[model samples]
Target: MDDFDDDSFNDVLGSMEMPTSPKKPKVQPSTIQPVPAATSTANSSNNTSASITVAKPASNPHSVLVHSKQRGNPILKSIQNVPLEFRDDIVPDYVVGRTSCILFLSLKYHNLNPDYICQRLKALGKMYELRVLLVQVDTPEPHNALKSLTRISLLADLTMMLAWNAEEAGKIIETYKQFEKRPPDLIMERVESNPHQKLVAALTNIKPVNKTDAVTLLQTFGNLGNVITASEERLSQVMGLGPRKAKRLFKTLQEPFLNK
Candidate 1:
């Protein structure tokens, strides 16, 4: 449901890359139930609604889920780092992470019809916490197309990614999948220079402590040394240091010297 137009969203056949021998993945046949003819009686009229059912897809562990439409795309085959499984029901080109999806777009195809992205975005509005618009610069001049998508991405809360070729996009998609369950501490700076900086870093590491509370501790007690010797009552006297945080700070600061 794109905001730009009222025309119903019909699935546009996706063929970003050239056909690769036209081999299709086998899918279980979908079944549909016929609607019963409407019946009219003197008291009331009734109509039966039809129902449809499709087989559920089998999930793989530590794997990326791909859309069947992207079967022939080079990105589908290039994701060699992690396993991938194809499913037709997904909206995005690649389901890279549990909470993330990627929509691959080619600039050359949409150069004449730029609003096509608007329709795609409308279909993908805020579905995932991390949405990536993986755009391929497939045209001689892609500046105008990128400009439009960039503006829309801001409004749609999408992370716009630029890749010169399919290989790079594949790598980016694979990276998202691999890092999905990983924590950011690997990339976080655990050490900082300067007492002022270290003070904040150290205190903030405690569950209930933060920069403001850390600064309050430093201001109330001269330094880390004084803080360590101070009683829990004195520690709790600092602004914002409630009984819990203050007791936690005192316990942490006075952790046995052998353990330290």
Candidate 2:
């Protein structure tokens, strides 16, 4: 009976008309069988041609659906949003500010390299026209924190790497005391060490003179000799040195030096 049923099925299939183009192989949903572990091992050792294939059912005939999620493109979007003028130019804000920054690292936080720090400061100072001031800060092993801070405060404008505590904060507050304003005469000796001190002193001899006038005098006349020889009219041409001050400068420059 089974042979008769199979023969009739084959006769029906052979009598049907076949399509001109090749059709996809139809897979029976019930025919998917997982390979057994023992069988897989035996197949691998024997190098058999038979292999297990996994097929997912297709919902749409045209497109293959991906299981993974997609991510937004931030870099490309940012580039698109940037202004046209700024697209090619790149400059740091600190370079434009023209302010020198010094890092005052504590011995605890960073290894203190005095020689390296001094060398860098000196080199950068020359390159940047004395605009650099880096210094390392530390309390002496035997001394109190206040004394250390006071000492370092004179050398550095800002502090870094110090532990955050009440004592440290109080020491920082105390450091500012060293920079209190004092009379100009009291700081005269300090200013004397500066190269501009002589020019400043010479300009001070005239009435109502300031530091800017002294700088202008140096820049305009080049040196003290040229300033002394400069006529009142020529001195008046310098910025900030008006006719009255120029006359006073001329008179003071021409006056004979007297023994104290």
TM-scores for every predicted model: 0.53, 0.27
**Candidate 1 lDDT, tens digit per residue, 116-145?**
665555444334567788887777777766
For candidate 2, lDDT tens digit of each residue in 107-157?
322222222222222222211111212222333441343344333333432
Q: Indicate the residue-level lDDT of 81 in model 2.
A: 18
Off by over 4 Å in 1: 1-58, 190-260
**Lowest-scoring 10 consecutive residues by lDDT in candidate 2?**
87-96
Model 2: lDDT equals 0.37
What lDDT would each prediction earn against the true structure? 0.64, 0.37
Error of 2 at 9 (Å): 99
- Evaluated at residue 168, the lDDT of candidate 2 is 48
Q: Give the range where candidate 1 is weakest over 10 consecutive residues by summed lDDT.
A: 36-45
lDDT of 1 at 215: 85
